[model samples]
Target: MRFLYLLRRPPYSGSLAAEAIDSILVAGVFDQRVSVLFKDDGVLQLLKDQQGQLLGHRSVNKMLAALPEYEIEELFVCARSLAERALSLDQLSLPVQVLDEVGQQTLIAAQNVVMND
Candidate 1:
């Protein structure tokens, strides 16, 4: 099955981001086709030099870096979200395909399941 995980929360905003990552990893382990999209404040999860341990949390950056190992490589980000935050692709820890409004809609439409966090 194709699973799309839409993350809209910041990494430090409780455990939502970590929970989403865990779910994605589980799905990948089951050999599901998984894709992840970071939108709004969720894009912050992809920013480099995150000090998650300072806040008593596991490093989100390290967690994200493991996605490829699980064969979950369809990572995407909202173009407008990055622009609003003044972040370029170079500022992110992982390389993600930037999607505009229409692209985002198309991707969501193509998913067999969409989970938002």
Candidate 2:
């Protein structure tokens, strides 16, 4: 099955982001095709040089880096979101396909299931 995971919240804001990552990893184990899209403050989850993190939490950057290993290579981010935050694609922790607003809509339309966090 094709699953699109839309991560729209900032990482480590409680358990949502971590749960989403866990879901993606589990989906891969079941041989499901999974793609992740970062939107809104979720794009902040990709910023480089993430430091001074809160105590008792796993590294968001580390989990992001491990996505490809789980065979979840179709990572995407909203171009407008980055621009609004005054960030460029190069500033992201990992490389991803950048989609404008319309492109994001098309992607959502194409997904069989969409999970927003």
Candidate 3:
């Protein structure tokens, strides 16, 4: 099955981002196709050189780095979100496809299941 995880929360706002990552990993482990979309402030999760350790939390970047090992490589970010935050793709920890409004809608519509966090 194809699973799309929509992340709309910042990395350290609370535990939602981490929980979503955990869920994605689990889905990947079960051999399900998984994709992740970083939207809104959730795009912050991809910023390079974040220091979650300063907040006594495990590094979200490090956790996200493990996605490739699980074969979950379809990562995307909202173009408008990044532009609004003045972030360029070069500033992110991983290479992600930047989706505009129409692209986002098409991608979401192609998914078998969409889970938002």
Candidate 4:
């Protein structure tokens, strides 16, 4: 089955992002096709050089960076979101496909299930 996770929150802002990570890992473990799209403030989750020490929590980036090893290689980020935040693709900790608004809609429509965070 295909699972699409739509992340719309900033990283480490309580448990939302962490929960999404758990969902991704669990889904991937079960041999399901999984993909994640970072939108709005969620794009901040991909920023490189996140320091967990400063936040007194483990780096969410650590888990996010492990996606490929977990067989979750399809990472997407919104182009407009990044642009609005004055961020560029090269700033991300890991490589990700840039999706425009229409691309995002198409991806979500094709998913068997979409869980939002």
RMSD (CA, Å), each prediction: 0.6, 1.4, 0.6, 0.8
lDDT for 29 (candidate 1): 98
- Candidate 4: the clashing residue pairs are none
TM-score of each candidate?
0.98, 0.92, 0.98, 0.96
- Choose 3 or 4, whichever is better by TM-score: 3
What candidate 1 gets wrong by more than 4 Å, as runs, is none
lDDT of 4 at 48: 89
Q: Which segments of model 4 are wrong by more than 4 Å?
A: none
Model 4 Cα lDDT, one tens digit per residue, 47-113: 9899976987778888799899998999999999999999998889988999999999999999999
Whole-model lDDT values for every prediction? 0.94, 0.86, 0.93, 0.91
Residue-pair clashes per prediction, in order, are: 0, 0, 0, 0
TM-score, candidate 2, is 0.92
Question: Which lDDT tens digits does candidate 2 get at residues 7-50?
Answer: 99887788778788888888888888899999999998888877
Best by lDDT: 1
Tell me the tens digit of each residue's lDDT in model 3 across 1-112.
8899999999998788888899989999999999999999999999889898899887888889999999999999999999999999999999899999999999999999
Distance from true location, Cα of 39 in model 4, Å: 0.2
Error of 2 at 80 (Å): 1.2
